[model samples]
Target: MEYMNIINQIIILFLIIIVGFIAGKNKIISQEANVTLSKILLNITLPFLIISAFNFDFSKNMLKTAVTILIISIFVHGTLSIVSLILYKKQEEGVRKVLRFITIFSNCGFIGYPVAGSIYGSEGIFYAAIYNVGFNIFVWTIGILIFQSGNVKGKGLLRKVFINPGIISVSIGMTLFVFSIKLPYVISETIKLIGNITIPLSMIIVGVSLCGTSLKSAFKEGVYYYASFFRLVLVPLVVYFILTLFKFKGIYLGIPLIVSAMPAAANTVTFAQIYNGDVSCATKITIVSTIFSAITLPLMVLLLK
Candidate 1:
């Protein structure tokens, strides 16, 4: 029954993503405008969401569980990230999306947290939050450096990572979590209001980002095959089997699979913009992979049981 509710919640989230895309398609919100919206969500809304999640005093019992989940979730997202990068290198260079895609995108933060939390409780959210922040930092610093080789301004990249609003918010959340401090109500609610906009806004931005692309190309250049197989099929399949071997179950396994399967990180586009790499190719990858996830994610979870 609890799992059913989670499933329903996830379906609703998917509907929201689609609705955002439709909204963009109809010009209810121009895709061009979403770039700024994305910035607002990342820099302002998301971080507050993180802090706002800490509204209650994290009791000692909840703290222990949170700590354990955080540590384990890191291992889950981090390990797969390394493996994905290696596999990414083996693929053709034209598909540069694979390179940036794996390192940066993990649905756990964006999709996984909300989906899993609605189902498994804060334990799911705790793990999902860690993967999103930790994965983002890794990609921004090490991952960006690797993919940034030919393009992007290499100088002061680390500086960019340090000041990233999302990154800064994670640092803030961790501080509050450790000291067990509750933020003031007014500020917390404000953050909550803004933060809640993340998923809906992100989905819409994704639709807007797809504005000028050719959907027909989804099957072109073998991009579709690689994007679908690597992200949806191959990566998660391997992760799924390996996780089962380790006997990790529930949100632990659930979070990684979802994260691993997320469409190429939106950050891929951000990195391309900053680094001047194959932005068009990266954008295409994001669009394609995200569309694929809508189909693949539900199927993957069905296989989980």
Candidate 2:
């Protein structure tokens, strides 16, 4: 009964995506509009979510565990991304960039947060948020560097990311926490008010973005499917065994496993656009991976539990 309940919860999220898929098929949401929503999520809402995360309670054990897990996972994600790119060396610049993004990035914030929370509750999200801090920074700086190696100026790299509202919000939120600054009851409430819009808005926007894209195009590419296979199954399974070996077990172990297994992020699309990577290919992979994750995620979560 408990296991079936878990599967049912996952189905609810998948159904949300399917609804978006149908809406897109009917021309209810334009790609342009979807992108606009993504910008709002990226620029305004996502940062707020990060800030709220800092305000949550964290034990020393949680902090230490998160730091260790992330350090290992970061290298894994980066290496896989590079390897995937190398495998496709003969492909055009755009297609290579898209695959590289798929390899390196996981949907920790946008998709991972909601699913993790539903499965493991608030504790899961808090740990996932800590993991997000590292992932977001890497995506902005290192990932962008990979994407824009030939075209960008070194002097303005940090500025390009820092000036954005999401990064700024994360900085402010973390700074407040570092100083032991407690947001007054009223003000913290206000930040929470503004921050709450992020998750659903992000999903809806993803739905909107995914509305009209062709899944068939993505399936036609064997390389993209291979990447999905590793992401949705192989990598998480490896992480599971590693966790068991280390004697770090239970919900903490299970949560990060799912977070690790998430599909490619939408931010990858932005990276692809800026760096001359393959936008169509990136979009295709994101669409297909997300769809498959609907099934893969529940199966993994249940087994891990």
Best by TM-score: 2
- List, in order, the clash count of every candidate structure: 2, 3
Off by over 4 Å in 2: 89-93, 149-151, 160-170, 175-180
lDDT of 1 by residue, 9-44 (tens): 768877877777777778888756787787786777
> Taking the tens digit of each residue's C-alpha lDDT, what string does model 2 give over 1-305?
27777788677767776676666677787777777777777776667666776775545665576677667656556656556656567777767667766767788878887777667665566567666656766677678766776466766766764566555765676566656678889878776776678766767766766755676776788887787887788878877877777786776577668887899876777777777777788788888888788878887887665
Cα deviation at 35, candidate 1, in Å, is 0.4
Worst 10 residues of 1 by lDDT: 94-103
lDDT of each: 0.65, 0.72
